[model samples]
Target: MSHPRNTLRTSTFSCTWCRVSVPVATADGGQRNHCPACLHSRHVLDQVTGGPSTCLGAMSPIAIAVPRAGDWTVVHRCVRCDELACDAVREDDNQLVVMRMAVRPLAQPPFPLEAFGTL
Candidate 1:
């Protein structure tokens, strides 16, 4: 039996930072761009064109954004090219890593918390 040319194969990729092998498809049938173990991604797709990008840089998880719809997204910044991209959070993603990114800004606030007291 011959398979179709466009047959979907089990896609897996290695994490750029942690070197963990991860599957491209999540358990809930959603596409995953970041590694579940380290929450790191690679600069592979063009955010504007929705096509393959030539910048093969290591994308580090910078922040977590919760949309009005309430779904959390992991924002990544490329180390080499400085491109930014966001990907949906997977169910199996590491909670500690996600939480750390979410609270990073608050942990090291640019402005003093005492300023809020005056408000």
Candidate 2:
């Protein structure tokens, strides 16, 4: 089935199992949308990010997460489409990345998550 064409530019989507925003791919000049670091995606084949596609396969995470988190989410860059996105470490996500991302605290706190939380 084809996805609806919404007026808004941002297509509200996330990992089917994790329910988190899949990163928009920039490696191909922002024409892909796969999760880097984790190499996972929702299989939304497109010439650009936030678009529609017929491929519905859940892009699996084949790489490691770089431990970048937001207010309550962790970022991953996909190896497939080179998409850079964030997931909140869901139970449904790959156990390895989930466990690895869980250690974000050991990192530098992931940018300005605290600042965004107050907003």
Candidate 3:
């Protein structure tokens, strides 16, 4: 038998990458899409079409984006289809993982950072 919606909301899902069981809801009662440990998610929704996706691939956390006036967002890329998606970063997410992604571009820039100093 199918479970109720409320029960499903409180259920836990195993992370596709870390294999850790995570709750669907956060401590602030917000829904979560990625695992807090590895910050990996599944490609189940289409960002371009705003509908369900069929790729069903493993999405790895690639970068961190910050809006003008909002919380940080974790960017993911699907391994199978190369589709991209972003999700809000939860308060309990791993700070180390988030920081690493945020500083990646700076840590390994395409061009020399010293060039910007001349400009």
Candidate that would win on TM-score: 3
Pairs with backbone N, CA or C atoms under 3 Å apart (clashes), candidate 2: 23-84, 23-85, 35-77, 35-78, 36-76, 36-77, 36-78, 37-77
Instruction: Name the 10 consecutive residues with the lowest summed lDDT in model 2.
Output: 23-32
Count: clashes, candidate 2: 8
lDDT of 1: 0.86
TM per model? 0.83, 0.30, 0.87
Error of 2 at 5 (Å): 20
> For residues 65-113, what per-residue lDDT tens digits would candidate 3 score against the true structure?
9999999999999999999998999999999999989998998778888
Candidates arranged by TM-score, highest first:
3, 1, 2
Cα lDDT tens digits for candidate 2, 39-73: 35665544355677555656554334444543334
| Model 1 C-alpha lDDT per residue in residues 68-94, reported as the tens digit of each score | 897899989999988899888889999
TM-score of 1: 0.83
Question: Model 3 segments beyond 4 Å from truth?
Answer: 1-9, 115-119
**Whole-model lDDT for model 3 versus the true structure?**
0.90
Candidate 2 local Cα displacement, residue 83, angstroms: 1.6
The per-prediction CA RMSD against the true structure, in angstroms, equals: 3.5, 12.7, 2.5
Which structure is stronger by lDDT: 1 or 2? 1
